[model samples]
Target: MVRWNILPATCILNSCIINIYDEGDCIPPHIDHHNFVRPFCKVSFMSKSNILFGKQIDIVDLGEFRGVVEIPLPVGSVFILKGNMADVAKQCISGVRHRRVSVTFYKMDDSKAPYRFQPDPELEELLPYQL
Candidate 1:
């Protein structure tokens, strides 16, 4: 990931969430919570879809919406979310015609960590592999 320049060397992803989208499934436009650190990534799999971006998204109908822009997310692709795109703009995925999966990776702010949170030692000092 470092070689691809998707993340800086100083950044360490410590949290993850998986989303499975079924047919006609959609996500409303919204920004991520402040608890997550910047420069997170969403990896797409199984199918392709357009990720909508806009300051104001209009709900046209059930599982349908209109946005200022639509970015295609291809299968096995990594869509990095950071800076203005991650903080200022609201993003959403429209209803998919088929099953799709996405895994998002984030770094939880240390100050926002839960009391029961314990750092995983194994994830520390991870270095990129040499192909």
Candidate 2:
């Protein structure tokens, strides 16, 4: 990610979570925890879908919801979240028609790391290209 300048040198992504979504599977709307650093990102794969963003996402029914805005998430694309988008607005993916996978990367606050968490030495001091 650093080589592509997707993330700056100051932001080291040390943690990741993989999400697998099956047909009819939906993700509830919520903001990322403060324990995780900002400027996080989710890379999509396998399928295309829409991500909803709003201050309040209302559940209309099982696998249904109402959001203020929607954004298309194409396969092999990266969605970066920072500032208010990471801390204020909530995001969710509605029930998908096909299997989908996403890998989310973020920097975890040192003080909030899990009890057994150990920082990976390889991810330290990641520097983006000078160009």
Best candidate, lDDT-wise? 1
Ten residues in a row with the worst lDDT in model 2?
122-131
Q: Alpha-carbon error at 127 in model 1, in Å?
A: 6.4
Cα RMSD of all models vs. native, in order, equals 1.8, 2.9
Clashes of each: 0, 0
- Cα distance off (Å), candidate 2, residue 120: 5.7
lDDT of each residue in 1-131, candidate 1, tens digit only: 65777898666787899999999999899999879998899999999999998889889999898999899999999999999889988999989988999998998889999999877787676765788
Clashing pairs in 1: none
Q: Give the Cα lDDT of each candidate.
A: 0.89, 0.88
* Stretches of model 2 off by over 4 angstroms after superposition: 120-131
Candidate 2 TM-score, true structure as reference:
0.87
Candidate 2, residue 49: Cα displacement in angstroms equals: 0.7
TM-score for candidate 1, please give it: 0.90
